[model samples]
Target: MARGLIKAKMLPEGKEVEFEVEKPVKVSDLLKMAGLSSETAVVIRDGTPLLETDVVKPGERVEIVRVLSGGAKV
Candidate 1:
């Protein structure tokens, strides 16, 4: 089984966390393992947006970030 590192910026606290997991795991799975919510975060692989069903390959760096909402009322 292939393995790689996944790093993410957790919301609320805004702290970064890193972990290693087997390759081919869904983005959802990565979120679960990283202790993040799938609804609030976006997964990116090698600077490309990856779907939850996308498989992460070995040696690939993944960044899961929480989407921030902000707006100015007109």
Candidate 2:
């Protein structure tokens, strides 16, 4: 069997990245691989949000959105 790469589109930057995974891994783990913090980012697939514990298999496409916080003091 051959391994497939995981494709992820990083938000804000709108850049696509790819990586290989021998087996299914947690969304959080993937974030770490992309140098993203789970606390500030989220994994979404098929237009749905995925939990940190959600399993991400190889050859799957996912979107990583970085949640930003800002407010105008009025």
Candidate 3:
């Protein structure tokens, strides 16, 4: 199994958390493993947005940003 790192924005606290992951898995799988919902965040690798079906490689660092929508009227 390969190893990788994931930086995700945690909810409630909105803090960025770093966690390790075993690669050869899809981005969606990784999110599931991390207890994160795919609908809540997006996966980015090497400054590029990756699809849920995209495979993450070992030693790769991915960022998970929370998807925020809706804003107060100005």
Q: What is the TM-score of each candidate against the true structure?
A: 0.64, 0.87, 0.63
Candidate 1 lDDT, tens digit per residue, 3-73? 76666655545677776777667888887887668888878865788888887654556677877666665
Clashes of each: 0, 0, 0
lDDT of each: 0.72, 0.91, 0.73
**Alpha carbon lDDT of residue 37, candidate 3?**
84
Give per-residue CA lDDT, model 2, range 32-58, as digits (tens).
998989999999999999999999899
In candidate 1, the residue pairs with backbone N, CA or C atoms under 3 Å apart (3 or more residues apart, or in different chains) clash, namely: none
Q: Which regions of candidate 2 fall more than 4 Å away from where they truly are?
A: 70-74
Worst 10 residues of 2 by lDDT: 65-74
lDDT of 3 at 26: 87
How much is 50 displaced in model 2, in angstroms?
Answer: 0.4
Residue-wise C-alpha lDDT for candidate 3, range 1-74, written one tens digit per residue: 75666665554456777667665778888788767789887778767888999987655666776677568767
TM-score of 3: 0.63
Instruction: List the pairs of residues colliding in candidate 3.
Output: none
Relative to the unseen true structure, what is the Cα RMSD of model 1?
Answer: 3.5
Put the candidates in lDDT order, highest first: 2, 3, 1
* Candidate 2 residue-wise lDDT at 58: 91
